[model samples]
Each structure stands twice: as structure tokens, then as C-alpha cells.
Target: MTGIVTLTAAGAIDATYRVGALRRGTFTRAERYTREVSGKGVNVSAALAAGGADTAAVVVLGADDVRFARGGLTAPLLRIVEVPGSTRVNTSIIDAEGATTKVNAPTPPLSPEAWDATLSALRDELGTRPQPWLVISGSLPELAGTGTPVDLAAVRAAAREHGARVAVDTSGGALDALLADPTGIDLLTPNAEELSAAVGRPLRTLGDVVTAAREIVARGVTTVLASLGADGLVVVTADRAVFARAQAPSVANTAGAGDAALAGFLLGLTRGPAATAAGADPLAVAAASAAEWGAHAVAHASTIVAGPPHGIRALVETSPDLDRVLTAEGEA
Candidate 1:
């Protein structure tokens, strides 16, 4: 799979505000202001492209918001579908302590005609293009009379029809919908909290995480890659289960770490014959790759702002970190 496609929401500007402290009726200075295109799918696609993958991003942008949508893209191929209104804008405020508060604007409703047009464009591209990897991520904007549901099953089916492997990173109702029918999903990458929410249980230990992940695979998922934050990652498949532990690093911003991790994992999936042979059981490799990328992302965040930096080397040096945690908790 040389080419990859990412599908999700596309918005214009990301207005980021930084405040030193929060208090009622107090004037605070703005630390930084910048505009950028941001979304989970978009970020992941950009990371993959930056990492040297033949990648494209498919997004819905209002006719008026085309410029905004295209502004933040650096990918070689970016396909946009013009809809009725301007794309959404998301605002985030980061406090000095690295806590973030975000507000997202509502997206214009997509008419039946608009949906058809967008789907048609995607189908044509996938059918005619050489992309072999498809990433369906992020949340859909609410539109009038539209429940904001993304047709994951249809997306998966389409990717498979075009001989592409699919990876999904989403949550809430959309996550529930995909888990309802996990067929055709080559990889399900979820963070620990998301995984616990999806499985309807609290996963406090590595064994618990492994058990839950295996249950997810039993539901027709080929593989389950669970990101355990500072604890590293837990990968589960029908054949084997492996855990990779990275020492807790000072995380600058946990925001894009998951997306970066996904990028790393996908990159590993397409690496070479060994990765291909590992097939769905490439959890360890994926985890290792994701850890490195995520560490980089965290490190990058630290230099620009006052926050925790993800220690890439520390994570790699700590082997069996998860095992140690499990053993200390008497769950190993």
C-alpha cells in the first residue's frame, strides 16, 4: 500500500489562545495567536505525508471556506468537496499549566445532493487512484436533519472494494457504530480511556486491557492496538498478544500524540516484508514506531511552549514497563 487517503471533517482556522491563569473578571494576556487547519484526520494525514508517505486528504469544505481548508494542507494531493456554507472553525485555549479548553463551531448541514457529490468524488478517486490505505477518523459536524453520523461501514466496504486496508480512530456514537460491525477494519487504534469506554469497563491493568482488546478482536476486528499513554501500548490479535512499554515522558501536549501514534503504526504496517508477514499482529512494531513519533511530537511542543516534553529515549529504554506496572499491581 503505497498511497493513503484520510477522510474526515475539514475546517478553516484554528484560533489558539494561551492564558497565563484563569480567574473570574480578570484581564489576562494572550500568549500566542495563530491560524491553522486542524482535525484528527487532517493531522494524521499531514504527519504521514511529512513522514514520506504518498498520502491525500479528503475533506468537506463549504464553497466559501475552500481557501481556509486548503491553507493548512501540505500534502501532495488534497481533494475538497464544496458544500453550502463555510467550513467550521475551532478555537482552543491553553492555560500556562498545559490544560486546554476548546470550542468548535457548528458545520453547515450537507444536503442529499452534497453528500452524493462528495461520495461520488471519493469513489472516483479511490476507484481510479492507486491508494491502498484508507484512514477514516475524527468527528463529523452536525448538519440540519443530519445526525452527524459517518457511514463507517460504507467507507470500509468501499476501501475493501478498491483493495485498500482501513484504519479507524474515532469515538462516541461513531465508535459504537463501527464496533457494531467490525468487519473490514484492519486496525482499531484507541487510547486507554476510549478503549475502556468502548468496552464498557474500567481497564486498570495490562491483563485487563489485553482481555478487553481480545474481546474487541473476537467481534470481527483483525487487530486491536490500544494506546496506554505513559504506560505504552497493548496490541492484541487472535494469534498473539504483545505489550510495549515506554517510560513516562513529560508530555508537552497530549493532543496530537494519538494521531502521531496512528501515523507511526500505519507507517510500520507498510514498511517491508517482515511487517507484511506480521500482518495484523504487528502491535509491537507499531507501538515502537508510534512511541517514537509521539515522542517527537511531544518534544516539539515543549520547545515552543512551556509544557512537558515527551522523552523518546526514556520510553525506548524502558522495556517491559507495562509488565512492571502489572506486577506491582499484582495483575501480571
Candidate 2:
């Protein structure tokens, strides 16, 4: 089906612990615990699938851990490629105040041969549909001997070959490389911090964000969907911008909210014609959906969403107040 296909170059076994409080250099007791197979692309695919979208995740796992990762995820939704060592483990700690502290282990670069296998798997999956949306999310690993990042350009090339659109959600050097020449990127989802980092300045107001997003839009990216925490989300393009926020829910965990938001955005875009027929701009529809789905994700303690979202209402503004101050992440 021509829906969404995701690539998770660095996958992990996620371990979450809920504690009353975290004390540095001291023992802490956890009140709850859960674990699952997780990666940014995995989370996006899972959320989209739960929301009834045809989605699949291409995950690279170690030979020893592939079985365990497979056991936790739906079989049809996964395309696993095996490497040599064990898969990395990431730990998350949520406190009583709903704050999340995450410790992610470093992933060693895949060998050139293994990297080729990963690309082959990606090509195989993309070949299944004429023009699927290919999402490459999460941290990227380097190539072993070269110490160079995985060939993102090659991935973009493959997507182009299959006439697929691309959405990227990664950070640091990998993100810089993509933005350096965003020729094939149709969409980019960067949270507040990532957006700040991209522009090399702090964004304290709605206008600041719009300016930064426009800079990237001018660089060839079609759309920039930025998450602003409590301030909500903003979608910016070359000619228009929209801001959307849903009624707040009691936030239990914010770990996977962005991934869920990206899933919703893709779903909305995939079904854009229906939204357009209803007299709404497809961009605004997507922003509203993203806000609602992100709200739904924050209400849960895990990255997995078992069902469709409910009880969430979004307010989208076509002409958002540019002067409005943003307080999320202490921006202002």
C-alpha cells in the first residue's frame, strides 16, 4: 500500500521505569516498569498502524536480539535486517511530576557491507508501493571503517527512484547534512530545541520560529512541522504558516509524543484530499491532527498507543499571533 514506510537505522530495546523521585547517587524505587522494542521510526510506524494507516518500519537489529525485538512488535509491520552485535538498550525514567529522563546508549557504526544490506532492505520496502512516504527517523549510525555517516543522499536517491516523498526527523550532524541540501525532503519535524539548534539561535517567540522554519523552506524543504511543547505545534511553508494546539491533557509521559505527532501529520497528508474537500487547507488539517495525536501520546506512559485517540480537540490558527511569547522549554 502507498502509505508510510519508516527506516530506523539505530533501533533499541526501551526500558522504562516509573519512580516517585530520582535522587542522584542514591537508590530509587520504581513504582512501575515497562519495556518494548522502540526506535523513532518504530514508534512512528506503530502509531500510524494503530491509527489504521498502512505502515511498516524497516529496523536494523543485531543477530542475537532480532528474535526478542520481533516478539514485542507486530510481525507484518516489521522488516528486520540483522547485523553482528547485540541491539542497544535505552533507559527512561519518569518521575511523579511527569518529567522524563532518558539515557540512550551509543550505537556503533554498521559495517559497509551491513550498511548496504540496510539500504537493500529499504529499497525492497519502497518497491512495494509506487509513491509511499518514506520516513527516515531517529539517530543515524556511522559507517565503521570510514567513520562517515550513513549515506543519507543514497537513501534520498532511492526514494526518488521510486517516486516517493521523504520525511526526516533526526538531529545533530545527520540533520545538518540533510538540511544542507534538502532536495528530496518533503517534510521535517523538529521540536523546539532542535529548531533552535538548526538556526544557531534561541527562539523565544512565534515569529522567531517562523523565521527559522522559513530559512529551511527557502533551502528547498517543502514544509517544517515544529513541535513547541506546551506552546503546541507550528507548520510553516514558503507561503503560509499555521499554528495548532489541542486542549491539554494530564501529561503522564512526553517521550514519544513527537513521534506520535509525526504519525498523525503523515496520516493527515495521506488523506489530504478528504480534508480539502471539506473546505480546509490540507496543512491546517494536518497541524490539528498532529496536535490531537501528540496530546493523546502525552497522556500515556509508554511509547505504544493501543487505540485511536479520543477526547482531544485542536484549535488551529491560520494567522497565528507572531508576537506571542513561547514559554515551553524556557524559551522566554
Candidate 3:
């Protein structure tokens, strides 16, 4: 993969409001508000672009909001496909305490023609220069009046035919559909809750997280990276496992922290090949990057901004010893 290309089918107008406090039973006036076009993949692209990486996004934009999406994102390349429906709006309310209350709108359905067009564009890119890590993220839109065949597998198959590696970050039925094939994905990133939901149980501890993630690996996933809020992350592959944690940074708002982590994880992959003597388990290195990036996102006011505003190296040094952590699996 040359760089990253995200499929942000579920694009949205993201709005964030800042207020002194949010009391459930009263009217709370906003002190400030910021709005932009975002989706999970869009957020990843923004953060990657912030880190000075070349990125691209393929999104379904409302015909009217094309300029807004293009202008707000950090990506230099955008393959825009127009659909008839208005883009959904997602709202996040951040309080002085850094707690966030989010309101996510339903995904807009894609016309059969629009979906087909999107696939065609993706194919063209996969066949062209700058082979990229094709990321299929966000929720699946319901099929609208467009009687597009629900052939999601065909999309992945087409990518593989063109020799592209895929990464996934999605939940609910869409996630289940992906997990069913398991080994088809190059990487899978899930927060604890999403991991639990996928395995049909509640994960309450790190061990629980490991067990659930291991199950996904047994089903053929190449690797599982589960983000556990302040506790850090668990990165597991077919042959090894590592648990990594970093010192907690002060929280700003946790809205896009997971996306930030995924963005960092991919960045780490691009850093260099893992040097085992340097404690470089590929998964472990990726986990370290995830913690550092996640911490930085939580330390910022906006998800699109760069890490912690401090730097990534200091935080990564404080994280767990990846090779030592492998001892848990009796591999050290």
C-alpha cells in the first residue's frame, strides 16, 4: 500500500458545541460551536493528513455540500459521488468537564447507480498509481429507491482482484458481515464495546478483551486492535499478543479518540519494518502508536488537529514494553 484511501460512504455534517456545563434537566446555552464534514473514515483521513501523510477519501456527498466537504477535510484527493438525499448531521456537545454527548443522524441511503459509481471509482484507483491501504469504514447506508444489489462482498472481492489490502472499522450488522469472512481484512480496529458487541457478550476487563479479540483471530482476522479508553489497547495477531498502556493525558473530549488511534496505528506501520531486537512486534509498535495518538486527540480541542500538541515520541516511550508484554503469551 502506497498511502491510505478511505471509503467514507456515510458522510455527515459534524457539529460540535462547547458549553460551560451540561445539566440534563435544564436548558444549556452553547458558548461556541464548530461544524465540518466528517465520517469515521473522514476523521482518519484528517488526522493522517495532519501528520503530513498523503491521503485520499471516497465519499457520497449531498450535491449541495460538495464544496463544504472538500474544503473542510485535510485530504488532497476526494472522489465525490453525488446522491439525491441530504447529508446527515452529527452533533457533539462538549462540557467543561470534557464529557461529550453526541447525536448521530441516520445514514442516508445510496441510489443503486450511485453505489455502482462509487465501486467503479474505487476500482479505477486500485488499478492506478499509488496503491493504497483501502479502508472501508463507517456505517452502511440503507438502500434507497436505488435497487442496488446488496453485494457488499463483491466490493471487497473487487479490491482483492486489483491487489489491495483492506482495513475495517465498523459496528452493528455491518461489522458482523465483515467478521463473517474474518481473514479477508488486513486489520480490524474496535473499541471494547464494539468488540464485546461483535462477540455477543460484555467485556469488562483486559482479559475479557483479549479473549474476545482472540476469538476474532481464530475466525481468521489477521490482527485485532481493540482500543480500551484510558486503559490503553490490546493488539493481537494469530501468533502473538501484546497489551500496551500510556500515561493518561488530561481529557478534552473523547469524540474521535478511537479514530485518532487507528490513524496513528496505520502511521506506525509506515514508520519502518519491525525490528524484533528493538522490541518491535509489528502489533506492539502499532499499539504504541495508537496510545500516543489517542492521548493526543483527547488532549486537543478538535479531532482534526495534530497529536497532543506536544509530540508523539515522549508518550510512546512511557508505554508498555511490547516484547515484555508478549511474555503473557509465553512468547518471551
lDDT of each: 0.67, 0.88, 0.74
* lDDT, model 3: 0.74
Q: Model 2, range 196-290, lDDT digits (tens) per residue?
A: 99889999899999999999998999999999988999999998989999865787878889999999888888778887898878888889989
Question: Which residue pairs come into collision in candidate 1?
Answer: 250-309, 252-308
TM-score of each: 0.83, 0.97, 0.87
Q: What lDDT tens digits, residue by residue, belong to model 3 across residues 1-332?
A: 35777887877778899999999899999999888777887778777777666677777778788777667545366777777757888899999977888999988777778888888877776667454677887888866774442457767887678777788898887888777876678789988778988888977666677778889988888889888766677787765667666654577767788887888788777664644556666656767777777778877676565533255442333233433322132121
Best by lDDT: 2
**TM-score of predicted model 1?**
0.83
**Cα shift from native, residue 175, model 1 (Å):** 0.7
Per-candidate clashes, comma-separated: 2, 0, 1
Candidate 3 error regions (>4 Å): 73-75, 129-131, 145-150, 274-279, 306-309, 312-332
Q: What is residue 291's positional error in candidate 3, in angstroms?
A: 1.1
Model 2 steric clash total: 0
Q: Which lDDT tens digits does candidate 1 get at residues 107-151?
A: 556665666665666676677657578888777554447666545
Q: Regarding lDDT, does 1 or 3 come out ahead?
A: 3
TM-score head-to-head 1 vs 2, winner? 2
Poorest 10 consecutive residues by lDDT, candidate 2: 323-332
Best by TM-score: 2
